[model samples]
Structures are given as structure tokens and as C-alpha cells.
Target chain A: MTDEGPLTPRVTGTVRIVGAGLLGASVGHALRARGADVVLEDASPSQLRLAIDYGAGRAATADDAPTLIVVAVPPDVVADVVERELRAFPDAVVTDVASVKLEPLRELVERGVNLTHYIGSHPLAGRERGGAISARADLFIGRPWVVCRDGKTPASDLALVEALALDLGATPIEMTPEDHDRSVALVSHVPQLVASLLAGQFADAPDGSLRLAGQGVRDTTRIAASAPELWVQILAANAAPVVDILDALSQDLAAVADALRAPEAVGARREVADTIRRGNEGVERLPGKHGQNRRFASLVVMVDDTAGQLGRLFGDLGALAVNVEDFRLEHSPGAPFGLAEIAVAPAVLRDAITGLEERGWKIASTTND
Target chain B: MTDEGPLTPRVTGTVRIVGAGLLGASVGHALRARGADVVLEDASPSQLRLAIDYGAGRAATADDAPTLIVVAVPPDVVADVVERELRAFPDAVVTDVASVKLEPLRELVERGVNLTHYIGSHPLAGRERGGAISARADLFIGRPWVVCRDGKTPASDLALVEALALDLGATPIEMTPEDHDRSVALVSHVPQLVASLLAGQFADAPDGSLRLAGQGVRDTTRIAASAPELWVQILAANAAPVVDILDALSQDLAAVADALRAPEAVGARREVADTIRRGNEGVERLPGKHGQNRRFASLVVMVDDTAGQLGRLFGDLGALAVNVEDFRLEHSPGAPFGLAEIAVAPAVLRDAITGLEERGWKIASTTND
Candidate 1:
């Protein structure tokens, strides 16, 4: 919807979103914005009415025959819903937005459902909370939408899903179901487990030590606050791939623990060093803002803990023509000021420093000056 | 230095800092700003000269008699340096800013050295990099500086260390050396190892999967980019406590992995749910900004990817008299705009949304509306 030139959505015919949760309502809102007709359905009548009232779409009717069917249910019931939709709308191109792709696809295939009308798709976008009330039309904008396909997947069926992604302002990525599951297992599922396991260590921590918690542990365990109800289903459905990654991680953890236990022994220190070094390399592989793999030069400035101080600081940056690549605000307990870490291009680091300093800002640190 | 009520420093006499690294140079700068005489020393000549050149302090001289000694060295050499500093300045009170305290304290006690004038203290403050060049005078401001003591410690000697902490604008926390080590092991050391061990799993991950990484994994693995040399030493020094936590974590991880592997088994799903639920509870224990254990309401607004857009948005908030508690900017791949998630007090959430919407900002989502 942010794009004005394209009033015509790529998706055509009547689009149906089944399940009025965050993703379903969001999809309905997006398709509706694109001048496409959308019908909504949910197992819960109250949820369906809520999405409809939010202007996402209208309630589905018995005569409604959708050209595209988006199955937006939980992972546990994805295959069952997809099967029902495929049978109900025999000619419609059916796709799903479940986090894990393979298990549902395999289950549908096992149920001997018709293969011509089904494709698996997932949009790598979400909010902390779920429900129709939290839906946003622009949620998928700029996010990746993976379309899972195989040799038997018809081009026309795949095209409908890709068109949905495009109309919703998402980048369409073509991947096999196996690849999708494996990739998410590595990037998403296992990391959730790791964060949870790490946060769980805080159970026995005394108040004195917990008081010393810094930004490092906070960032490392931030995802541990996710809802367990949703995670249990996601992890259970992708158990094979998740287990593979966790088993490997458990071994590495045990090795590091053993090395730390006898650090003065031959190669013990080396083993510990190797693990952290490998981590440094692994983290380096992640792309930065806007899908670029380049690093940003970071500088920290001290700001008084008062209202409108950040506004004035950012206003000065804008007036100085400095583009902030990324920003984070760090506050110490009982400190009268906060440290605002601004990331910018390496070439503009000097200008940002000179301009902010001239504007009466205190520069705490700059990286690789 | 940000506080200008008085020029006289609480810390008295010629304070000698024996390491010219980040902590040492920062301590020197802060004390110098407070009009305290400081003498500097380092094993490396260039490092010592660099600290002096950076306006930290004058180099140590043969006749330099210090009333206080701060041993700011690495963890492995902490005891050795502390022993020498205590012996060299027999009349002066000595302290070291080592990350781990129990091992060095035990080693010094085992050496049968006089412990009356020595204290183990650590300021929980640091930058990602080390050395004099990256040091800042306000490093310890608003941070917790732990002072380790036992029954034999004198009140006068403890007062000197506490005054030093007050001079640097850090809160003085009293704890036993055993408690300090165990606390950091739970909060800092274990989290570091967990990040490293989890990031190490990316060795065999395909690039496609890595590209699918979202903010969840990015935050969870952020600290994995830390320098390995420092962590190896910290982990090694705090081995016993760290191993205890890791052992417990290893057991929990093994249980979750086993549960996921056979999710259909009795109570298997419950096991997985319990781990994440425990994480939820543990993360909830961390203190929020300014040491308050409170939650903030979050709302997301769409901002066009342009210079000064953020400035404009924040300016609007400031003009509307809305104070932002926390903010994060998330951009999607190939998206023309970014989502700005602003966290504010729940009472002011309605005002923020209404004001932003009236100013032509697109409201993407709101919490618990």
C-alpha cells in the first residue's frame, strides 16, 4: 500500500484467507488494499467477525469460490485445513503460510490429496503478539516469502502463490519443501531453543548477579520471552531437523565445558578459543540492514535522561545531513544519562563525529576511527 | 565528569593505576577530571605512552609513592600483578578490576601474602575493544562496581575502595568473592558460552538458510561476535561456576532435544513447553530501564526509507510531549520503507498513536488496544 504507482494488485480473482489470526487478517487487509475481493474464514466465529470488523475482509459465504486459497492456520492443523480447502475449492490454487513447510506437505501427500492445486509458502514476517486486532497490511512488505515447490508443482499453481507474495510487497523465494524446512530449522527453530536454554540458566541466579546483567545477556536471551504455546507446535512439527541441530549444539557445548574444566591442560584453551572464533565467523555471515553484508561504523553519544533529548539529537543529525544506518539506546541503572549508539557508513563516521560534537553532544566511543 | 557540583574528588592521595588498558585509562581520565593526582604504569612501554598521550596521567617515577593502587590487568595475571602491587606499595590500599574474583583471591591467599591492604573489586563496565585509545572517562558512570570482602577486611580500607567507586559515579555493591564469581558465571560467563556454542552451529548451514535469518536469531547471537581471547580467559578463570550452569543447561537441552525427537510420546510435548515457559519466567526477572521490573507498551509505525524521516517522526513525538521509553527500527529486504517500533508507557500509548496518525504517519499495529 506504500507504493502508489501500482494500484492494481498482481493477485487476481477472489482471494480467500482461512483463519483470522494475525497472518490471515494481514493477508486479507493487503489483498483488499490491492483492489482484489477477499473472503475470510475462521473456526472461531468471534475471531472471524473481529477480522471482518477491522476491514481486513468480509465474511466468507457458501457460494464463495476463491481463485486463490491461503491456509493460515497453526502448524498442527495446517495439513487438515489445506486438505479441506483443496477439496472444497477443487480448482483453486491453495498455498499455506505455516512456519515449517515439509511436514504439512508430506501429510497432505500421504492423505492422497490432489497434488495439482497445492503449494507450500511461508512469509518470514511476524509480530510479538498474534490475533486479528494486531494485523497490519504492510506486515509482509520487504519480508521474504518462500514458495516451496517440487518437480510435480505446476508453474501456474506456483505463479499464483508468487503473485500473492508480490501483490503483498514481498520478495518471492523459490525453494523446495525440504530446503525450506532445513533452512528455517537452522536459522529460526534451533536459535529459539538455544535462547530458551540460555535463559533457563537464570533460574538459579541470585539477585546480586542478576542485578549485574548487561546488554550482552539481554540481547542473547531476548527471544526467550516468546509464547511457548506457539513454539511447542513449531518445534514438534519440525522435530527431525530441530533435533539434528540441537544434538550438534549439545556436543559443541559439552566440548567447550570440558575444555573450560581443564583449561591449563594441552589444547584445552585452544578448544575454547576455537569455539568463540567460530562464532565470530558465523555471526559475520549474517547480512546487515537492507540485505547488505557490509559492516557499519558505530559511535556512541551520551544523552541526558530527559524527555525530548533524543528528538533534539536526531534533529541535529538530520540537519547535519547524517544518515543513521542503525540506532540503539542503552541506559545504565541509576544513571542520569543514556548512551545512544548510532551506526553509520564508514565514510561518514568522521562527519557525524564532528557535527555531533559541534552540536554539544558528548562522543563516548567510535569504532576503528 | 558529567556532574559538576564539586571539583574535589572523593578519592584522595596519589592514586596509582598499574594497567594502561581501557579500564585503567578511563579511571585515570575520570580521576583527572575530578582533580585527583594519578600515576600510571604498564608492562608495555607503547601502551603506557599512549595512555599518557591520551591525557590519562603521568608515567610512574622511582619516587612515586601511592596511597591507592588499582591493578587493571587481564584475569589470568590478576593475582600476580596484585601481589606485586601490594608488595611494592605496602602502605597503600590495593584493588584489581578483574572480571573473575574467587580464583585470584584464592591464589593470593594461598601465597601467604598480607591481605590487609588488598581488595578485589570489579566495575561491570566495558567496550567491545580494549586499550587506551578506546577508553572513555564516563565508562563506570551508572554501572555497578562490586567490592569483594570477608570477615578480616577493615572498614577503613573498604571505605577507600567505596570512595573510589563513588568518585567514578558507579554504585558500590558488596559481595563475597565466591558470590561474585558465581553470579557472573550465571549472568555473564554462561551467556557468553551459550552464544558462542549456538553460533558455532552455523558452520554447516547453507547460505540460503542464513539469509532467512530474522531479528530473533540476530539478537540471540549478537554477542557471538565478541573477541575469543578475552572470553577464553574469563571462562577459564570462572570454570567451576560456569561448568555447573553449563552442566545444568546441557541436561535441559538434552531433555528438550529428546522430547522433540519423539513428540508423540507421553509428556514429550509438555517437556518442550516447560522449557520455554521456564525461559519466559527467567527472562521476566531481568530489570528493565532504571532498575524497574516493568513492561512497556509497543506500537509500530511505517517510515519511508529516507534521511530525516526518523528525525521528523521523533520530532513529532517530542512536540506531542510523548516520551519514548525504547525504540527499534526494522527494515525489510527490498522494502521502500521501515517499521519503527516505539515502546512507551501504556498510559501514553493512545496519545502517541493518535498524535502520529494525525500527523500523517501510518499506524501499522498497536498492543492490547
Candidate 2:
């Protein structure tokens, strides 16, 4: 996600960021580019300096009375830092960008902290690694930045967070703290655990078995490579919701395994089929590029596995005025050619094939489904 | 995989193929293109006719004498079809392409069907849907063809199957029936089950949760869309081995769930960290595009979401002689630009970045790793 519109300032006033890690520095960078004043602080002096050197923002000064405060810290220390920030800047509207919403909010509430100016928000954006060095100005652009509001939250307070989201080119989605926690549990937390669990299966697998691995296992386990230290905190902080989803997943897994173990038993195969069909339906629910996705028709064309061969094909598509909705390159082991699977709107599929054929391209699949 | 080298047929004399499903018709198509005489048969007359009309092969006749027969029936009836084919052409070296090998081999042995001539093989190749309508002549190209052998099997009989694999542009790897079934169980069967189970969780999930779904969930569940009817038979045939792996996975899942449920417990976070680390190691074992893959350095460049922008980038790369090893297009919702994450060799990354920058392309990620 990148900021594409005119780079004019939208957010006003001096903003103080309490951490200078990936998320913190990214927020500073985005706001700084919008011509707003950003003051950065961090427990690590080197980190704060590194972000300043990178032109994300200036170092914090004691005399600076910030109008806004963004607390971007690790999940374990989030509530502690948010509590300190609220007390330090009583009049400033405070927001924290932590993965989980309810735990920190609940912690702040139990501690009897005045959270009238505090808002819990999460921007669903990250890279594989995190650091001030890895921060980007456009990291949150075009991503969903969830803004959590409670009954006590003022309309003016919510507007400030929304403006920050929009200034970074992120879509601001309104959700309650409880709903936000549960939603992320289902979407992010549980999926991380599942991927890690599935990938662990391969650790002990024979090399021969691994040699046979295909795109399926690779895709299912790709996210398992995220840092364990970071995930341990996220999972622990959001334990209840994550556990709820994991328990449900465990039950489904057990039933399917039991059915496979006794295939001849009545309705055993039926149970397995239903579970798989449920997965098919589940995947269809994901929103596509434009909206709730209507699958685009795909065509697999063969391209010579050289530098310029793909360029020739894509250049031809550009010439044909065919907008490729999605595309993936499939390189076969020890093969001279690679398959380019391009998805397009069905209306243009026939013309795309016709045009490519006219250009002497070899179409390997005419399945059209 | 395309037949890039030559059009010469390696296997001599008339070849008979039983079953006109995807694999059967594809074999016919590849063999016919090599100027080899092929006779096709299926239990259903209409199916056989469709294969012939598609130019896969001519229909079988009673007078036809075959030197080799390929049994490409479903796993459930593999032994029956192989037994029939063996009786019809006793002198011919026969092979059957079935997903599970041990069961069919044991069945054929139990029924006293064959003492010689039959070879059990499986080509690690398939599309989302099956049928002659989806068959391609190059379907077997660049894929692994697992050939199972026994002490009693003759060298000449094994040679025939290997030759067929080579002719179809596949790499033949010799494996025992036990090894083949167990290997496929680890890489293919268990993975399919995990994907199905994970996907099933989303079937009842809230739309708000699914809207927050990202690429990790999308990749992990993509294979959940496979045909459940076919998987039921395959999973049933390999029940014992699949259940063994699933049970192991269940234990891991339970341990992590228990740990997450009570984060304050001793060794709680350790248990979660270990599972995730194991997955990290497991995914690393997967082979890359090149032999035992060394990761290619990647650069994420922003492109306009409209048509032809990618063509320009690739064309520039081609001109600069920077071979793009791999690429994926990242489209954002309601954003004017997309990101092209291109993987190239580390040696070329510096030059590639410089050249692209000179060409006025905005490189989003400077993190080389």
C-alpha cells in the first residue's frame, strides 16, 4: 500500500510518537511527509536517533506540548506505556497501534487510568522483520487500519485517529475492542498457529518426502518463518480469543482424522468430504481485489525461461489492452519453459487468447475454468 | 513443461491406454504427438469417443495387439483394470498410474492377478479439475514420476515405464511402493487435510473477520478448493499413514493450545516458541526453484494499477539484461498503484536497482533480504 494522491498535509498539530520501531517510525515518516510536525521518543536512544537520522521525525523535547500521542510498543509493554503516555499528556488524544485491542484496554481500565482520550487501533500492515531500519513511509497505505472506539470515546477523538489513517493512505475501519480482538484471532492469530503447526510437520520429514513438496505445502507454511519471539508475545497477549479459535480448529481436525482412521464406518467418508467442501466454501468468502471476489478466468501460457521472453508476452498483453487481474509464474524443475498463469475478466479471455496466439505464443491450457 | 528438445518417440511399437480421464488422455496426447501408434479405451463409450475426437488417440479394436499397456484408471479400480489389461496382453509390460501404490499392489498380489509385467507408478501432476476436457499433452512435463519396483520385477519391465516418463518430459524417480505411499502421505495427503481443516474454520466465520484476511490465509487455504470426492478415495486408501501424521500434528496443536490457554504456566511461552521454530526449520527444508534453493534477492517496485505498467518494468529489465527469477503483483483495494515484488540473483540486485531507479521507478523496499 502506497500513498498515491497529492502529497499535501492533512493532519495538523505537533504529534508525539512514544516508540521508534517499525510501526512507530513508519507513522512518523508518513506524518512528516504530510508537512506535520512529528516528535519521536523511544526507550532505546539509538533507535530514536536512527529514526531521526532517517528523516522520520525530530527528537522529542521536554517543552513540546503534543496535541496527539501515538504509543507503538511491544504487546507486553503496551498497556504500561499507554498508561504512562495518558498520564504524561493528559490533554492530548492518545492512540496505541498494538495487534490486540482488548487486553491492553482492559489492563488500562483495571488500573483506573483515565482513558477518555485513549483509543486502541491496529494497522494490519507489516513486513517479515521489524526495526527502525525497516520502516517505510507508505507501509500503512492502502491497508486496513482498524480504529477501536468505546462508548466513552468522543467523536472528536475518533476523528483524529481517522485523519491519521487517511493521511497515510490507509482505510479506517471502525470496530469495538472486543470485536477487534476476536476478528484478529480468527484471521491472523489462529492462522499463524496453524501455519506453524503444519510447517512443524516437515521438520522431521525425510528428505525424500521434502523433495516431493509442491506449492500447496509452501503456501500453507510461508508465514511460519515470522520471528518466534514476536509471535510468542502476540499469542500470549491475545490468548483467550486465539485459544477459542484453536480449540474449534482442533475439534474439526480430530473429527476428520477419526473419519480417515475408520473409512469403512458409515458416514466416515461423508464426514471427510463435508470438511473439505467447507474449506472450499470458506476460501470463497475472502474479498478479492475489487470486492467480494468473483473469480476471474485464468489461462496458462508457456513462456521460454529466459530474461526477455516474459516481457514479450506481457508487452503483448499491454498492446492488446488486456488488464491482467492476477498472474503467477510457474517454473518447472529442469524445464526449458515456464507457465504464466494469468487471470483476466472473462469478457476479454477470448480476445487475450486470440491475440497471444496471433503473436505466436504457445497456450498450454485451454481448460478455461 | 513443454517438449523443447525433439519430437522423436522413445517407446517403440503400438501402445494401448486404458481409462480416458485426465492422465490417460494426456498420455495419449503426448504419445500421439511423437508419431507413436496409440490405442485408447475407457469403460464409458462417450468418454472414449471424446478422447478420440480431441485427437488423443483412436478407439481400441479387438484385433489390436499391444506391446505396452498403460492403466490410468482411478485408485479404487486400479487393480481390476490392471488385472484385465494383463489378461488381455500377457506379454506386454503393463503399468498403472495410481496415487496410492501399496494397496493396489497388495490387492493385485492377493488376487493372484500378476506375477510379472505390472508396474505401479504415480506422476506428481494434476490440475484443479479432472477429465479429458482438461488434459494437456505436456501435463507430465517437468513433474516427478514415481516408479515403484520390487525384487521380482524385471529390468525390461521397469525400463518401459521410465521410457514413458522421459518421453512425456518427466523426471523418473525410482521408489518402493511403501516409500512412494508414505512420501506422498507426508507431502500431499496430510497437507491437503490441513488446508481443508483450516479452511473449514472460515466457513462459519464472520464477514468482518474474513475481510481482514491477508495473503497468508489466502495461500494456506487455496488448495482447500480441491475436489473432495477424489480426495476421499485417496485418503481412504492411505488411511494408516495419514492418521499417523495427523495424530502427531494433533499433539503439537494441543500442546500449543494448552500453553496459550494459560500463559502464566511454567514453560508456557517456551512450548509455543518451539512449535513455531520447528515450522521455521520445516519450511526451510523445501527445495527452491534451483537445486536446494538459495533465496533470490527481491525488490518491491510500485506500478500503476492500470494495464501495461508491468510490461514497461519487465521490458526495461530485459533491456538491462537483469533476469527476473520470480515476480508477484500486489494490488491494493482502491489504490492507484500495485507493487511488483521481483526476485533476482543477488549478484544482479544492485545493478537492477540502479537501472530501475535511473528509469524513474519508485522502489518501495530497500531491505535486500
Candidate 3:
């Protein structure tokens, strides 16, 4: 095993993973791939065997003494597992990978667990499915792993958790548990509920109405297909923050509905337009792939729906040495052609359009940044 | 120009396109490409000239008579344009391609305009940007073009409009004006409002909250960037139906908020889970690319983020003679590796896994269909 990247943080001793599900098994796989000692444990014997068989880690034994213990379990059981792990391994730094943070910390506080060696962390990485079989060594690569630390957390313990995140090719962001919960409630939890509710509207829709569904509805509702049982726990665990956001959203929705109901009334059109414009500004505030608010100029290029069309376009882009910041392909059902919307830095937009057009590709339009 | 597909509907004689905007110019281009005479007109001289220069069609002449007239204008101006086109060419079958069908039809009825030669159609196709510059010849190809025809409409006029949709590579589905409006309200208009309102929540979010935005929020709010002015017109034009859907959605959202606010209460968790499960079922009812609800099995293959990794994967799949039904690539920022989720027919899932694994590729997991 080779630990070859500059981002790989070094850990000297054994790192034990509890609850060998997707996140736990993945942490083990990633750590084992980096030539680190890893011990795996799970309440279910079958899951532990599967993780070990998959080369994630070896089975934990009483003789083994771990330096770090990562609690990766469902949100409902996270606090219990963390408490038990901290009690069993007094010398080990205890952390968790649960989606929710504050609830577990409060639980530990209420139970009067020692705070000296516990640091809560959440690696913002996952797959649609769960289990050891779905685990991968690179699951955390380039993802954000948030570490929750308070004034009471020991500096050494926090550093150890951050190192674990770095060793797994993740960027560790320090945040308070309250801040973590609020941030995720806005970005992750609220979006899930919105998608679910929007998709639920489709349940009683006329059959032909759904036949008119296009890419807009599909993209908006894609996450609605997530595991409902799992989401129920995540949402309930962070209910206060999520509810706060949803209540605000409900008020805004009511305002929009009122305006639409009386569109011919004075100021109704302006109200509706103002809400939409705010949405435009809100989306603009979102960071791009590089975690920056920098915008990229995009161009739509028309291409026939042939096998080599996209490959040829990418080849041409390579020949021009123009890096495509992002790409999305749009094809209508039954159309013989599709459009490739490619994003590039503003400086290279003109060059890309000229080069591609000179190479006989039709440039449909250059969209505003 | 070659028309070489089973879906290519044939039409003869001159076709007049009023309003040289995106849809209008695209219709002209598609018809002109099929060796038909197309005349373009717009209130804006500059836009008309641009569309003509872009090979959409030639400028309309006073002496020339058209067999068919297509009114492609904004929702607010659609009725006026359709009425003018009907009077200008009494012998021609007239159709308007506004997104909302019933409003314009109602306006025409209120004015008591001659309805013998008029039909309302809306092609479910568009790019983010508008105007002649964004138009493409294949924009409507493979998309659903809805034609609203009543009992009073002449069969020949309705057939002409359907032929026009088919000739432009679209599938024409006959619906009443009321049905068309209601369907678009549920599928298109309501989704737009939901996305806009959800994104609006970000306007006043805390400074660091949006930094954690993931693909889910991005997908749910993608369409919120649409032009506010244009959407105001569309929402107001179909205000009745859209308001109806929004009202129902608002009620459901309120219920969800109430449940999330008190998750520990009896049945609160069950209510939240039930709502999410209903969303899953709703999404499952949406047809796939080929207009079927057949679910495809998926396999996740790990790949480094080096250039040509996706190309190589496709090449290998081609060599194995396995058809990829759909695919999605997911990567985190600064990650050195990514996962390619490839979908294929259920019958070939095992073979694909074995073939790729033998070729030295890592198959992470096979997702349930």
C-alpha cells in the first residue's frame, strides 16, 4: 500500500471503526489503503465478516489497543455507540461520522461522558446505498469532513480526528456542533424535504401530466428517491434547525401563492418577480466545484447524437488546450441531435467558441455569466 | 439538408413563422432544413434580420402566400399574434406555440375571433436563454409537442399543425386546451415555483451555510436562475391552474413542517417517512427516456480523475458489446478519484460486473433496481 498524496495526513497507530456499515467500512478501506493499522467492529456479525472479507480491516479483539475509535452508526444510535467506545477505550480519541452532530453531543453531555478525548466529526461523503459492499477506499476523496470542536475539546484529540480525515483524502473543516447542524439544515436537510414534497405532488397527478415531465422536474426531484427510513432519522435528529428553515420557507411559499392568486391585483406581479429575482441571487451565491463563488461563461454547442460525437468534441477541446470547467448534455427524447453546454473561464470563452466553430461545430449561443 | 428518420414527419408548401424568437427561429430553421420554403417575421427588425442571417428563413414578403402560419411569441403577446396571423392568411392553418394553452385560447374566444383556422400548440422544449441567437434547428426534435384541438376545429387544420410538429421531429399529442394548461401546471409551472421558493431561502442564509451546498440543492434549484420577467408572465397567464397546484403543495409543506417540528410526538416520524415514501413512489411513476417506466440496474465503477477515464470506460463497454442505458458521474472537489454509475438492462447486470471486474476495473456495488 502506498500513501502517496501531499493531502495524506500521517497517523502513527491503530484506528478502530465501529458499526461497519458504508461509512465505517469505507474509512477502514481508505485507512488500510494508506498502510495504516485498522480494526473493524459491528453489532452484526455478518456485516463485520463482510468488511473483513472485502479487505477493509481485520476483526477487533480484546488484546488490540486502538489509538482512535470512529463511531459510524445511524443517527439514533450514534450517541450510545460513542459513549460506549469512549468508556471501553479510555486512551483512544473518540469521534463519529453521523450526519447529525448536536444531538449526540447533548446526549453525551446529559450522560456526563468525559469530554477530554471525544471530537465529533462528519465526513460529507456517502453513496445512495448502504452496507460494507458499497464501501470504497476513495469515498472521502476531495470531500469535506467537518470536525466539531468546542472550547472544552482537547487540542490533541481534535488534531487526531483532523488527521484521520486528511489521511482519507478529505479536507477537515472545523465548526461548532450548533453551526454544523444549522449549516446542514439549510444546505442538505431542507433541500431533501423540498424535493420530497415537490415529488409528492406527482402522486395524484393525471397520468398524462407526468408524461409532460421534463429535465426540470427530474433534476428537482432526483433526491426524493433516497431511503425514507434513513432520512426520517436524520431529519428527526436535527428537527429544530430543519424545522426553523422549513417554517421560513412555508411563509415565503404562502406569500408567492397569495400573489399568484391575485395576480391582477396591485403590486402582485412585482411581488412574484421580486421573489424569483431573490432566488437568482441566492443561487449565484452558491460556490462552484472549486469552493469559490467565481462564475464561468458557458457556450452551447450543437452535436448530432452519434457515438463518437461527444468523444470527438472532447478531443477537439483537448487539442485547443481549453479546459472545460463544467459540462451538461441536453437531449430531448426522439431528437436526432443534442446540445452540449460547456463552461469555461470568461477569458477562454471567445477562444473556445472560435476554435470549435472553425472546426465545423455549430455554436448555438453564449449564455450570460 | 437530409431528413432521414422514421419520426420525420413530411410537410409541403410554404410555412410562415411569426416572431423570430428562439422557438420561432428554431421552427423556421427545422422546416427550412427539410427543403421547405419558410418566411420569418418579427416586430423587432434586428431580431428578424438576425434569424434570416442565421439561415432560419428569409424575410416575409407582402405578395407571398403561405399554406401554414406558426405564431411563436411570448405568452403575453401570443393571442394577438395568433389573431393577426389568422386574419393575414385566411387560407392558412394557423397555430401558436405559447407555453400556456388555455389563456390564449380563452382570449381568442372572448374576442370572438374566427376559430375555423386556428389551433393552439406548445412544444415542450427550450434552452435557458431566449431570443433568435439561442435557437437551434433540432430544438423540438424528440420532444412532446402538444396540440389543443376542440370539436369545432377543422380536421385538416389540426392535421396540418400535427404534421408541422412531426416535421420538426416532435411527437404530437392531442389534448384539449384546458387539459394542456392543467398538465403543464402540475409538471412545469409548479416545479418552477417550488424551485424558486426553495432557492429564495438562501437569500438571507448565514454566511457559511451555502458553502456546504451539494448536488442535491444544486439540482433542486437549477431552474431558479430563469428570467424573472419571463416567468412572471407565464405564472400569471396560467395563474388559476398553477395557483391550484401551489395551494396544495403549500398545505403539504405545512404538514411536513409541523411533523418535523415535533418529531417525538406520536406518529410524527411516521408522517415524515410516509411523505418521503410517497415521493419515491411518485418519481417511480415517471417514464424513462424511451417513455417506459422500466427501471435499469446500475453498477458503480471507481476511476481516477485523470483525463480520458470516462472515454476509456465507454470504450471498454463498447468492446464488451454492452449498451449503457444511462450514466452519472460523481466527484467531490479536490478529489483525485470519482465514481461512474452506469445503468444497463437488468438482464445484463451480472455480465457487466464480471466483464468489467475481469478487465481490472473496481466495481464498488451494484445498486438495486
lDDT of 2 by residue, A152-236 (tens): 8999888998999998888999999888899888888888888889889889888887777776777788888888998999999
Across B1-369, the per-residue lDDT of candidate 1 in tens digits comes to 256578688887999999999999999999998999999999999999999999899999999888889999899999999999888889999999999999998899899999988989999999889999888988998999999877888888899999999998899999998889998988888898888878887765788888788888888888898998888899889999999999999999999999998999999999999999989888888766887777888888888777688888889989988887877887676676788888888999999999999999998887742
Candidate 1 chain B worst ten-residue window by lDDT: B1-10
> Could you arrange the candidates by TM-score from highest to lowest?
1, 2, 3
> DockQ: which is higher, 2 or 3?
2
Off by over 4 Å in 2: A1-4, A366-369, B1-3
In candidate 2, list every pair of residues with a backbone clash: none
Calculate the i-RMS of every candidate, to one decimal place. 1.4, 1.7, 2.8
Clash counts per candidate, in order, are 0, 0, 3
lDDT of each residue in A1-369, candidate 3, tens digit only: 123555343876999999899999999998998788999999999999999999999999889899999999899999899999899999999999998999999999999989788998988888788999888887887788999888887788888898899888789988888999999999899999899988898887788888888888888898998889889999999999999988888888888889988999998999899888989988877766667676889997876655456657766776777766666666565555666777778998888899989999988668766
Which docking class does model 3 fall in? Answer: medium
How does model 1 do on interface RMSD, in angstroms? Answer: 1.4
Candidate 2: TM-score, chain B only: 0.97
- Model 3: per-residue Cα lDDT over B1-369, one tens digit each: 124565333766789999999999999889887778899999999999999999999988988698889998889999898888888789998889989998898899999999888888999988888899888887787789999888888888888888898888789998888889999998889888888888888888876777677778888998988889889999999999998888888888888889988899998999899889988988887765566676889998876655455556666676676766666665465555666777778888888899888888888668766
Candidate 3 chain B worst ten-residue window by lDDT:
B1-10
Using lDDT, give the best candidate's number: 1
